[model samples]
Every structure is written in C-alpha cells, then in structure tokens.
Target: MDRIVVQAAAFDAGAEIASLREHDASVGAVAAFVGQVRDLNGAQGVDVLELEHYPGMTEASLAAIVADAHARWSLRGVTVIHRVGPLKPCDPIVLVAVASAHRGEAFQACEFVMDFLKTEAPFWKKETADGVSRWVEARERDDIAKQRWQGAGADEATQDKATHDKATHDKATEGTRARPRRA
Candidate 1:
C-alpha cells in the first residue's frame, strides 16, 4: 500500500494502476477510480476547488486507511492520492486503485478503500463557486456511514460489546445444556 501527493502536478490514474500490477505477477485484476473537480455542484457552479489537510497528519491518516484495507482484504497492492491546494475544473482530485489475485477482492477492496478515504481521512474542501466560498462539513450521514468501518480494532466500545455478547451467549448455552429434559 502507498499514498502520495503530487502538489500542483496532475497524476495519471492509469499509470498508478500499472505500477501496482507491474510489481506482482500474481495480480489478476486491478480496479481503480479517479475523482475530478466538476464545473457545477448542485445550486452552485464550481469555479475552483481547494483541498487542505494537516501535513503529516493527513498522510498518517491515509496510510492507516490503506493498512486497514490490507488487514481486511487479501489485496496485492493499493495506491491512493488526494491532491492538496487549488484545483481547476476537470482537474483530478483523488485517485484510488487496488490490485488482487481475484477480481472480486480487487473490486471490493477498491470500493472499501475509496469509501474509507472519503469519511475517515481528514481532507477539507473549500469550493469557490456561485460567488461563494464555503468549507465542507462531514455530513451527519458521513459520521453514521463511517461507523461501519469501526472494527474491533478501532475502539474499546465495539470490543466491549463483543465481549459482553460472548459472555452472555456462553452462559446461556451452558445453562441450557446443564438443564435436563423434563420428560
């Protein structure tokens, strides 16, 4: 897994995918997606989009997400890039690619990686359009959506819930087995 930034330079998504597949002979498939700045966003027509992130923290967050994908899926390679700074319309904003031994894992891991990047990574968007520049917020739904990624390794709350459930289930099973049939 690798994460990078090209500053003002544009990235080739296809080139990134090729690099991932070229390294491993076992890679049977590669899935990738690129997001770009659009000319219009709903009521507002986009002029330019600026992305910002806390330098070291941004990279760390993204690297952790890729690592999570490796742990969750049998992935061969993953590459991600989320541009920072001003981007014109049609300029690429983000790139994600996944390679695996099978197409299923490749596709699913690609989606998983992209989704996690959207919600988990701390990238802020400032869209200057419709004569307004506003900061984007992580939607309430974004919070709820990201909760699905909260694995047992993520927090004590989830681990605690699993432990509690396990203990309750074990006790119930033991009690049921210990009770003889009433016949």
Candidate 2:
C-alpha cells in the first residue's frame, strides 16, 4: 500500500494506525505523531488556518521523505497524511507514523519523517486572525531538527571525499609558506 496521502478531508488517526498495524503483523512497534491546528499563533488568537500545497510536488516531496526514512532505518511500514484547505483550531494538520520490528527504529523514523516534512515539503500555511491573514514562516527549530538526520551517514562518501581533499591539501602545502622572492 502507498504510504503517503495528501488530502483535504480529515482522517481518523486511530484508524490509520490500525491500518498500518494490520498490514504488517511483524511490526512490533508503531510510533506516530499527529499535529493539530492551534488556537493561538504567537500572541494573536488564530481564527483559522489555510493550508495549501503544490499537488504533484507535495506528494513527491513527501514520498522522498518517506524513502529517506526507509533508507536510514529498518522500517516495515510508513504513513504520512497531510491535510489541506481551511481548518479550525484543534483540527488535525498532519500525521506521521512508522512501524518497525523495534521501538527505536519506529520512534526515530517517525520523527525523521515529520522533521523533514515540516522543512522540506512544499506546503504553505496562512493564518487568519482579527480579519487579517498572513503567511507563516518555517521555524528555525524545525530546520535544526531536520539537520540532526544529516549525521546519519547518508552522505558519508561525500564527507570522506572532503576529508581526503583536506588531507591532500595539507600534505602538498606542508611547511610551505609563500614569500616574495627576488628574480
């Protein structure tokens, strides 16, 4: 079954979790997160939140995030659902769930999918408050959270190359200081 869903209709989180579990009995642990629309935005009271996304681009981005999680962890199943259109406070915004043989992989992969989705996915949010609407910006903390996965060694080959280049440069320039010389 496809693991990514982008829709305007609301989804039942409990049902979604059950579906993931039923699909794979070998999954011993399931970790999930459901994000909701908040009533408050900073100091202002939020009346509604409108979520918009680029259709194909959004789905592709989400699929890539899920694939990245699978590549980094031993995952049995993954579910990512993101809602679009107008939503009120307490309405579910997103869901990220992962199933694995152990709790650690499920927990980490669930978090990884969400962190990347928040920063990497092509979703735009607009908040309406006091008859005014404004687009929200990505949080710095979200970026920092996503960065933690970079050290997972997905780019170890690239890192190795950088290290090799530095070593080569150091060896080539060992004890060499450039100075003006007389012709």
Question: Which predicted model would earn the best lDDT?
Answer: 2
Where in model 2 is the C-alpha error above 4 Å? Answer: 41-46, 152-183
Residue 23 error, candidate 2, Å? 4.8
All candidates' TM-scores?
A: 0.73, 0.79
Please provide, for model 2 over 91-170, each residue's C-alpha lDDT reduced to its tens digit, 9 standing for 90 to 100.
Answer: 99999988877665677679888889999899999989877999998799999887766754655456446545654664
lDDT of 1 by residue, 110-129 (tens): 77677777886778888898
TM match of model 1 to true structure: 0.73
Candidate 2 shows a clash count of 0
The lDDT of model 2 is 0.81
- What overall lDDT goes with each candidate model? 0.73, 0.81
